[model samples]
Target: MTFVVPVHQQGQQQTTSEVGILNNDLSLEREGALGLLERRRNEVVNRDLNTSTTAVQRNQEENGDDENAKKKQQRSQCSRGCKKDWLGDGWCDSACNTEACGFDEGDCLGWCSGDCKPSWEGDGYCDAACYVAACNWDRGDCSRWREQGVDAVERRALQQKLRQFQQHRLQLPECKCERRLLVNGSCTPECNVPECLFDGGECLDMCNAKCSKSWLGDGDCDRECDTPECAYDKGDCASTTNATLQAMRKENGTLEVCDSTCRLWMIGNGVCDKQCNNAACGYDNGDCDNITAVVEIDYSVEPEAVYQFCAKEWIGDGHCDANCYNKPSRWDGGDCEGTEFEVEQAAKGIGPQYDQ
Candidate 1:
């Protein structure tokens, strides 16, 4: 016979032997069956709980992997910012990390760490550090320094050194040294001066001197001079008549004097005046010849007997003149009256005398 037992064992475990006793003896089974059933129920419940816990853990791991992938995507999209392992380390002190201790929550962490330093600190030196906890201890970390209270002497020394450094930096080969200083405050090599003078100054040794006037320096004389002295004191003076005469004498051994006797002799010989025609007298002026001659011509027309005989038929014989006979006659003049007349004239005059 089966028996039902009521048991109130909550939050407790029952051993396998106890369960066996309840199943074997009906009296004991009735008494502890409920405990055994509760224990069995607890085991099944614990198993379901373990399975739920494992599923939750798995979900959490998956979520963690998704978060890591999102973080990697965010880092990759970070342009114009520091690409270091941390975010917010770009220009203008933008890199920041609120999670880190001693870092300003709203402030950029990239600015607080790494090679980036406070403005008050100069070139990573301790002397340039600000009077703060970060700067005084760890070389200006986690601190933004102010320049208001800097020592005047130290500032001056730093400025002087910076200027010198800048001047040295500007000494590049491409700078214009003579005209202006470079961006780095260094001077360039001097520029060379041109050889020619722009202000019309005296010519340099390499330049040749040019004269504006003839007879100046080695230039030729321009005009004639009638002075007694043949030479000119001033280099650019005009040529003298005596000098010209001497030059002429040197060119030609003898000179033909253009006196009154020479003029009379030229006129008596009927020659054109040399004074009127210099080209005919060796470029000199004297009396020359001017003679003329006369020519005669005849304009009378000679007669032709054949033309006269042919013209007589139209001119009525004795009325025909020498002009009519001299003129050309057409081949078909009238009829045989002219032909017979022409033949008779030709026989009478022993052939006509023709004018060419």
Candidate 2:
């Protein structure tokens, strides 16, 4: 029993066979095109390799040729006129003296046995003509006053070395000397010669001539000496009653003065004396709590009496009176017992029994 296909089914089967044949043809064509491309790539690679090898070989051959040519040139030059053996034979022969002979291959670096010419003796040129003894050593020109070496060139070099050595051997004046130590940027007592400017100006003023150690503590205050170099002339300028501060206040026309008292009695009084509130007075012996106001002093009363009066008035006022500082009474009604000033005084081993 054979099964027969319908007419429509038969046409579809025929169309499918044709399509399969066309696909096989396309696959074969694609493979052939790929093979051709691969062959072309291999050809290009092989050709490039060969070309690079050839260029490298050609460059090497060219370099070798150049070297051979240079060698031939040198050989020709060495063989002409002066043989290679005669070039450095220690004799400065006229035949081998040309530049082509390498200047006799440096064989003529020293004195030679050539005839001396009087005209060329002192011409300042170091040649065979002036190298002989009979030329009076080139009339003192070839060696330029340095004639002990093998040649003029070597002598000149030796002269330069001598100059450098002399320069290196030179020494500056020692600062240890009195003359140099005075200006040596440091203060020293040994150099304090008053005749020397300001005793070298270190122990005194560096610029002002008048500010010297000679006038530092002298009874009279030199206005120019009123500087740190002279310790502000403490002998005269320290007290407010001194002439310096008084004159300064008078110049300013202000009777009020900042009391920079150093005396223990003037510090820490109940009154905030203007001059007493400074470090020289132990910060007014710690009495300057309120700097906005300052109590006036009655000039008619004795200073000690005034202090006693002020101490009594400010007692037990929540502050210690400076005048009562470390006093036998430990004044101020014990207000200073726990204060910072009291602690500081205690640290300093100060007490009512100890005198300042």
Candidate 3:
């Protein structure tokens, strides 16, 4: 009797197996054929692996030999599904510290030593540390000056304008809220904010001001607590010059009537007003602490016209935001590179032209 058998190789190109005809008595011939086919399969696998390795080498050469690049390569080695849950779970898996991941949800923050938050990619401030391919050329912040086609003259003028704007902004009125207090006499807030220190003990009610210790020395002069029995609001209102309104004392020793605005109109109004970024108004009822960015503001116009620049939705939607521009470590995800206007400039030879 005679038999014919087929041998399959585990390779994509070798889907069809080799066939060998054998005589029942000729076992030696069948063994030789099987061995030959096995060797052929091995060769195909080795070739495929070598080809993949060469492609990787070429990519590395183009990207340069940076630590981030190496980490990016490691991230590529693993599929997203493999590291899905662990990507941003507060544990910097060290293995998943690539930009493709969320920098381990900022858990690996100290590793870079410089600002490399994924959100800080294009926030206008050029981060020297993020000037690499892995970080998308710092999300285009470093090269945006040239890419936007600005000539030396324009660059100088724009820089001057920026400086002036910054100085002017500094002159703007800054409002502060009074710090909350606890039983420990420590200056802190009643909330769970670690940056401000949280008070665990029960609030102490004192001074016959119908208020707790947290409200006695609070910056805002509480009407009920302004009596001398309350030590004139624990001296929080000593400099309040407004005799009639008894308004809150501003940091500059002026009086700011915050009666209606701070309590009703501004707090919980869904706007993170700079004046409300303090304990007096519950930190704008938690709005000021949300993930927000100032994408655009025309300081050339009146400050009132552009006061509400920060918006929570602009941080991660993959668009280069104006507020995030030039701000180191305050990126707009990975969206910004150069401006469309700059691209136009490049065409006119007034600025650097990058290949699209």
Q: After superposition, how far is residue 259 of candidate 2 from its true place, in Å?
A: 80
lDDT by residue (292-335, candidate 1, tens digit) is 11111111231100010222344334332222332243222323
lDDT of 1: 0.33
Given candidate 3, what's the lDDT at residue 104?
59
Per-candidate TM-scores read 0.23, 0.23, 0.21
- Candidate 3, run of 10 with poorest lDDT: 195-204
lDDT of each: 0.33, 0.49, 0.44
lDDT measured at residue 182 in model 3 versus the true structure, 0 to 100: 24
Candidate 3's displacement at residue 311, Å, is 4.2
Clashes in model 2: which pairs? 258-275, 259-274, 259-275, 259-276, 260-275, 268-322, 268-323, 269-323
Q: How do the residues 166-205 of candidate 3 rate in per-residue lDDT, one tens digit apiece?
A: 5576321221212212222432222211111112211112
Give lDDT: candidate 1, residue 329. 34
Model 3, residue 165: distance off in Å is 28
CA displacement after TM-score superposition, residue 148 of candidate 2 (Å): 5.0
- Please identify model 2 stretches exceeding 4 Å from their true place: 1-3, 79-356
RMSDs, each prediction? 49.0, 31.4, 28.5
